[model samples]
Target: MPRGTDHRPRYEQVAAELREQILTGDLAPGAQLPSTAQLMARFDAANATIQRALKSLKDEGFLNSRVGKGVYVRNQPPLVIDTGAYLPPDGSFSYELIDVETLSPPADVAAALGLADGEEAVRRRRILLHDGQPLELSASYYPADIAANTALSKPGKIKGGAPKVLAGLGLPQRAFVDRVSARPPTREEVEMLDLPVRTPVIRQLRVVLSDDDRPVEASVLVKGAHLYELQFRRLVSDPEANDV
Candidate 1:
């Protein structure tokens, strides 16, 4: 077929061709895709057409690529994160703290919280369920200075969970900022969460700060495919309120 000659877009045709291969088992889970040059030859199309097709698949959660590695089939689903509206009376969702560990913070994590490189921190992993369905895998981290002095620093205290223990420590409830993104889960997450190889997962990174503007906790939440939705609202501040 001529390049960009399809009545429908050529890129769409290219994406459809790859999708067919995936459905037919020709491109199995973890299979590497042909190189761009190779695809150009196979599809008898230009580099731009092949790239557009690859971009479509990637956006649809069907492919992933590393800096030095070629594209590979993503063996997981997208997580649906519920960014529920922030109402005055909303309460924290129920969760079961499954495991806790104190370890050196990862580079990306340390950077996110502005901690020194190689600093020690507490890692708490929890399984959050709603109505008995696994909703999210939540991992939270606390800086050593704060966490070390509390019950949360201990080995077994995570079982008591976060909100209760934090309240016990006298840290009043404060503000939270949530950042959202979407991508396919890693191979291990796919198996652990019992999701299909093609499912995409939604990732929510929440940073909770104390009233004094100090970083208290950071949480990474991964939700299962099509399980939840996120909502946001704009709040207008009243200028005529008391200035006293």
Candidate 2:
């Protein structure tokens, strides 16, 4: 055991330490870990405890074991979500339409769509899949008036995605704002995403604005916390002034 005051269980502490190493590339992808006996000696723990730690990491997709060789770090790369664009999923991804209906949305979503109290909105619920794995659970809301009689109110994918549909209706998407947070996955989320137990979820509430600053769409996007990372890039407004 390394000298420290982390009060977690010994196995959990060992798992956390090894997880950090894997994430930081200290344990490179495909690199085999030390032998079980070496790990037990290094952590000053019993062989069973070391095995338990390895099992935890393996369950989390950080490590893999060979039948006769050894445990090695898995070559898994976290998905990078670019925050500045509304790019549609490429060929490797697909959308599974869960449902479409008109209903009064949550308060925050209502506010985002500028809906009046009790005013209904059309919601398109979908599961975004990347190479057949669930990547995100998304629910996009549209003002009832704007969505009525359109594909957005129906129960199938919109050709070219919602942006194109909105554009065809003369409400071309101009910009979007996202508010992101992370918390424990809801029961439904855990089931839908097939997330590991206790894995948190990252939620992004995105509001899309059209011409004349009209709020045309709002979506609630949720992804497993461990599977993706958000990327944001902004230009320095005063680069000259920032010179050190």
Candidate 3:
């Protein structure tokens, strides 16, 4: 990935460069950034441009200023949620099951799960906790045909989580397609995640697929932008993937 390929402004280009370094661990958390003069020399950017770039990172929760001290990468590592590790950690963390019921899913969820209009789904809402602090709010949906006679349709917690239960039903999850975005949290989400302010939240819509790309589950997740990061990798080595 070359910086010259991006047509964004110079400051955004610079910020993107630094942001990649941070994300790829070229610059570790809490690492002190190079001096502005040094950065200016590196990016061939003016003082104002450099400051704007740094400010962008600050606004995005990527860096923090110490006044007397120069800006440093945020100390707390973002909770990593990848494809295989999408579920909350079982042993290291805990969660609260807010509600479980068979109800009509949202439009997007119904579409993702291949449900027809007016088709009901099993809705399971939960809140994940880390170190006794609310970390994320998740709402999962399953089609009635798939969840019937299963723990998912019940009004109690499912042992070993929903994935395991689905597996037992011979509809094991094989892959995930995640759509990530950011927006204002709802009143319920704010209270559930215990957000101190009305800051924008990172939201993800994840569709879990079984064999033949059959979607078995769809989940909507909302979390504090300051609390988590999403990582992805591609197997294709070129622009075209033969088996993507």
Q: Per-residue error at 23 for model 3, in Å?
A: 7.7
* Predicted structure with the largest TM-score when compared to the true one: 2
Candidates sorted by TM-score, best first? 2, 3, 1
Worst 10 residues of 1 by lDDT: 79-88
What is the lDDT, from 0 to 100, of the residue 52 in candidate 2?
A: 89
**Candidate 3 lDDT, 50-106, residue by residue in tens:** 999998888767899998989899876677877456565567687789898888999
- The whole-model lDDT of each prediction reads 0.71, 0.88, 0.85
Candidate 3 residue runs with Cα over 4 Å from true position: 1-74, 88-91, 237-244
State the displacement of the C-alpha of residue 176, model 3, in Å, after optimal TM-score superposition: 1.8
Please give the lDDT score for candidate 2: 0.88
True-structure lDDT of candidate 3 = 0.85
Better of 1 and 3 by TM-score: 3
Per-residue lDDT over 1-244 for candidate 2, one digit per residue giving the tens place of the 0 to 100 score: 6887778789988988898888778999889999998999899999889998998888777789999999999987666779775444578877798999999999999999999998999999999888898879999999999999998898877888888889999999998889999999989999999887667899999999998899999999999976777887877999899889
CA-RMSD of model 1: 12.1
Q: Model 1: per-residue lDDT, tens digit, 1-244?
A: 5576558678778888997786556898688998999999998989999998888788656788877988997774333233542211323445666777888776656766668877878888877655455667878888887788677776554444566676666665487778888998987667656664455788878777676766677878787644445656546598567466
* Window of ten residues with lowest summed lDDT in model 3: 83-92
